[model samples]
Target: MPNAIPTTELYLIAMAIIFCVPYLIWRLGRTDYFAPLVVVQIVTGILLGPGVLGAIFPDYYQFVFTKDVIQSLNGLAWWAVMLFVWLAGIELDLGEAWKQRRESAVTAGMALGMPLVFGSLAALALIQFPGWIGEKAQSWQFVLGIGMAAAVTALPILVLLMEKMDILRTPLGQRILRYASLDDIAIWAVLAVVVMDWARLERQAIFIAAFVPACFLFRRFMTRLPERDRWYIALIWLAVVSFGADWCGLHYMVGAFLAGVVMDHHWFDRDKLDTLRHNVLLVMMPVFFLSTGLRTSWEVGGAVVFLAAGFLLAMQILGKQAGVHLAGRLLGWKRGEASVIGWLLQTKALIEIIFATVLLDKGIITSATFTALLLMALASTMLTVPIVTPKLQRMRELISRDA
Candidate 1:
């Protein structure tokens, strides 16, 4: 039988419209204020959810964003995350990072190792936090998970921050970008293992390992074809590879990411890549971000909420700084340079936030902790834009003086 139209559709419908409106304003070149756009989405989501407005109008809330509907929303959220991750992977040309192997390794180490260790340790202090939101868990596990979430680097945000600060062309900026790129690679691979869609992971690892080699091998075999035809044929094969990755359990995004990386060394028209990105911005990302904000809860917070938020932010800052200092010493790099790298990697994003939620659903963590963790990520990304650029500039001053 054809399914009846869900009455709960309206709440979701409201969510989409409210969240996208600000993003649209930002996109139309009307707002220099970008962070507020994301904040509004998060706030509006809380305002309309059962946590607040729904409490006053029980029937109205249930009629729209019912349990079933919310469940569906949650499912779609993860899918969007997977796609986001895939797109994230596609953004960096992994092979290029491989060429700068030692620097890249050092950069990745300083970027991830610091925040991770500190965040986890700090999280241990938070494991016993009491809360009724999210599926709850022991303090230690909760802290460990929260620690990872706080330490994460949001690659997309870092790129935006770079352009916003007009530092993209600077020597230091290039190095940070390279560091950010390396962080993206490590984070994505870590996510694959931790988030646990094994089928996807297995297939994804194979594609990533095989992609560069297979592409070159195919290039040699297709040597007889006209250059134009050979390239397009390979693109088709790339799409097939993307499809294969999707089918294997990773999501089509991992496939798309692999496809993009494989094509990086190819001499494609620059306009084509721009067009592809344009289309994605026009449609997919808006949908993804809007959908994410719609699920945020504003009313479910309390006094401890502030504590959770503050702790996470502090950890992100101090932990990353410590990481940079440690890594710089180990790699025989200067303290200032290492600090710049640390600041750059302090931002978190959709991947970590979404992963925590996934863990919450499985009862591995409590709702209070998860909610606190999500806030930690939002704060990490939102705050880094203001913190990193200025701090790095100061570092440069110190460096020039030392020189």
Candidate 2:
């Protein structure tokens, strides 16, 4: 491998292309209705990665994503995702869910449970085909991992979409957030369960056993600090917890979420936190997306990957719809409400990618499987605004007529 360009210069060039190309396409192509800029960014990542662009322009791909360049990019990707996940944890409104406990529990449970069951069934079928299951994963782990990945609500991306839809402050939106938040908790817990290493079970046990008291002490310490100091302190906390979780075999992402979950969302200013998230997404997360794309493969055959992705998407969409509709019937929600909620809840992107990435990292799933899930998540997320926008408009019209 001859170095045609300085490693640092190539990295800068990669970063420039990462941000610029995606922005131009997203702005010029006007694909926001079906694919938000973030979605476009993800798609671009795949194209720039080995599966597409590298396949087409092998020499250029090698020149840009060289080993050293990739390492530098990976460091940015890791911190970016951790910060994003931590922010998501901080945004969790469990207290609000507790207030709406009955409604939240029923809706969240069904919304999550149905897709999980459906996805696990899909996993079972895929496992029989070979090249789908991870080498290190058990039958149960692979099944549960796929199921849970399907059930994920991508709370952070949910917030972004909801805000874009102008529903973030609405009662209906708050209701949706509560359900997603509860599901988020369940998603991570299930991940922890799936990744549990019996050989290191004692270490996992010790980590959990110690984490509680540490959280309490940390919370108390955070409370005493000035708000200005909290942000800096929290990053330090994120690093520590993430390290601990990885050390215990749970993975750093889980630790990142746990670090955020225990702290008070109100501890930091909401607007500033939102700004921080947006900045990370704008600056750092593109690297994550690119890194994610670079991992995509079609070794199972492109046709098989697409077919599997289609099947999983159908299962997730139908399963989520069925579950939400069931809850609506039981709770007596108005007509059209369930459909809208179901579509919105089915939105998956950031968190789903993270979940799939973690599974890939743990050798619990093959890259082919990851690629399928990636496609599924992109389609799932892209469908959200288009599907829900019209429903929301009709909902408002109905309210107007009644008034």
Candidate 3:
């Protein structure tokens, strides 16, 4: 199958094109207008999706928007996210992460707390939406997932943007880094609690139980071992990890993420995992993101849909603004600093979008509600493209001057 072309190969090719087109837009727009690339990517997805282009090609749109294809790609996309999230843990310079712990916690609490409340309520209100809305999203679990995702921030995206603007090394940038890192970790832990399947949860517990002591033991063992054979042991664990999270309620990637954190000490060896993560991120991240676009269908209809959509936007703006504002006040940070940090966390992402899709597929939510939530998420993320530039410029001036 790897080498053979299926009848549906064209759809796959189209999907691939959709994926890269956004990145190109991002690159091209990087210096031109405000977050032009981000805007283009999301708009491109909407255009290619049933929302726009899907209307033009309803029949073929089936292949493009099929449950299986979009779902599988979403899976792959989230897997890439897992690797990236895992890599985040491994790359953590803990000393630096720890230095700003106080502000990190303050900011994280602001970002994480408010949105969680807003999203959960949004999810609940969606059920009351009483329309062709996604019924699957009406549940406590599904609602919780939506809230958690909304309440959370996209660490990888934020980090990438901060680096691009050269804010990461600055004090405010540093605060964002610390705060975003903590937020990322919180996201993982929340996912684990809400979504881990039975098998996955079991393994997760074992990994958690053994992690600290095992790290200590591995540290000692590795120091004493002849350098020649460490690769063999590492290879075995890699295989174990590939299937590890899969057995859990989570994906193999989640297991892979935990594997990364557990094996963080292997950072010195670097070659094996870093190379794998780089490959995964480069090849699959965009694909995963594109898949998100494809799965989005405007066909979902209902009064609740509009309500959910409006609520999502409101929560995103209000939640971030409130969270960051509070965190800033708590820390005596400037209004601009808190506002920027708040915006950073509330942004939506492909992984959480896909994860919500997963819940929808499992019949965990009603279709209308699921579609509504998807619409909300897509809108929130797409809006970020427009909002980011103004937020970043103001933050840079305030933070740079503060420094």
Candidate 3 lDDT by residue in tens digits, 1-403: 1323353675577666676777777776663344435445545665676655677888767655556566666666666666665565565454666776776677777777887887777667655545433443235667677777577565555665566656667877677767766776777677666665554566767766755576577656756665566546654554466465555455554555555565544435566655655576566666655655565554444454666677777875687778778778877865566656666566655445545655555455654555565666656655554566687787668768879
Where model 3 places Cα greater than 4 Å from the true spot, the runs are 1-12, 19-52, 62-79, 130-138, 198-239, 265-281, 302-307, 354-358, 361-363, 366-378, 381-403
Write candidate 2's Cα lDDT for 1-403 as tens digits: 5796899899999999999999999999999888888999999998898999999999889988999999999999999999989989888989999998999999999999999999999999998989999999999999999999889998888888999999999999999999999999999999988887778988988998999999989999999999999989999999999999999999999999999999898898988988998999998999999999999999989999999999999999989999999999999998899999999999999899999999999999999999999999999999999889999999999988888
> How are the candidates ranked when ordered by lDDT, highest leading?
2, 3, 1
lDDT of 1 by residue, 1-403 (tens): 4225554655457456655665665567544443535443444444555545667788766666655666666555444554455445556755656777787777677667777777777676765444532343444445555656666776655666666777767876776767777766665455444433453567657766776687687657666666567557755765676567656554454455455554443444556544554454444444455444444443446567667777878877887888767767877886567655676677665555555655565455665665666677666666665666677778778788988
Models, CA RMSD each: 5.7, 0.9, 4.9
lDDT of each: 0.60, 0.93, 0.62
Q: Which of the two candidates, 1 or 3, achieves a greater TM-score against the reference?
A: 3
Ranking by TM-score: 2, 3, 1
Residue 145's lDDT within candidate 2 is: 98
